[model samples]
Target: MKKIILTIIYILTLSGCGLEQDSYLVRWWNGNIPTKLSDKKEKIWDICFEETKYLPENTKEEKEKADMELNNCLHEKGFWD
Candidate 1:
């Protein structure tokens, strides 16, 4: 009985509410974007989504690198706002 309860708890924890609709990468991007990039929000988001959408969110360092790369891509495209 305890094993069954533990299994149920693990399943519930893994499959948290709204996990399908919003990905970890998307949430991270949404939270980490600089305020200066807000004026051109749509295009910035598009670049970010397009460039980093396929990146693996496995570690904090990877995520930070992805964010830096996204910012660099935006700056390279001259999309300052």
Candidate 2:
């Protein structure tokens, strides 16, 4: 029984370690505006877009700034160019 409990605990711990969050975004430019994004390459673009919705709306500037920051974060994590 003790061995079974230990095994279960070990399995749970390992599973938790495997469930990692994707926290990166890649970007590319097209024409005069930037286009394309890969949030950790998992196709979580909608989630990423939602997360960036807090940007100011005075101009496209705020959105652009957020995109740049997200791109940098992805690059630092070796997930973007």
Candidate 3:
């Protein structure tokens, strides 16, 4: 029982590493993108777009809204510098 409990705990800890690992969270119009914590502005933006891509069911209007929200979010995060 002890050995099984330790194994289960180890597996759970390893799996949880993939969840909520990103530090910076940006809520956009239709969805949100999270990024690993980094000081590089370009990296943050790249992660945002890469992570927040639309699905097949997403409408064009939703995409447009997300674009506008992304721009606003970037500006608010001071990427304009």
Candidate 4:
């Protein structure tokens, strides 16, 4: 019983670790993107787009990567603040 309880606790802890391990990019998106003011959204988006435009988006994975880079740029430029 003691070994079973410890194994369960260990498994639960490991599972919970990944649940909260979202990237900073994801956290910024989840916590800030929806609440951003409309007026500033355009300007900020323009900057991020320009910064990440050189990244290729020709494939699905490429597009996803570019999107992540764009989001990272947005987060760095105070989009999350």
* Higher-scoring candidate on lDDT, 2 or 4: 4
Decreasing lDDT order of the candidates: 4, 1, 3, 2
Local accuracy of candidate 1 as per-residue lDDT tens digits, 2-80 = 9999999999888675465467655664695334445576677696679877777689998898888887887776666
The CA-based lDDT of model 2 is what? 0.59
Ranking by TM-score: 4, 1, 3, 2
TM-score: model 3 vs. ground truth? 0.37
User: How much does each candidate deviate from the true structure in C-alpha RMSD?
Assistant: 10.0, 15.0, 11.7, 8.4
The alpha-carbon deviation from the true structure for residue 31 of candidate 1, after best TM-score superposition, in angstroms, is 16
Q: Compared with the true structure, what per-residue lDDT tens digits does model 2 show for residues 27-78? A: 1122344445555554444455566667675669977898876665545556
On TM-score, the leading prediction is: 4
Q: Show where candidate 3 strays beyond 4 Å.
A: 1-39, 54-57
Q: Alpha-carbon error at 80 in model 1, in Å?
A: 1.4
The residue ranges of model 4 lying beyond 4 angstroms of the native Cα positions read 1-37
What C-alpha lDDT do the candidate models reach, one value each?
0.73, 0.59, 0.67, 0.82
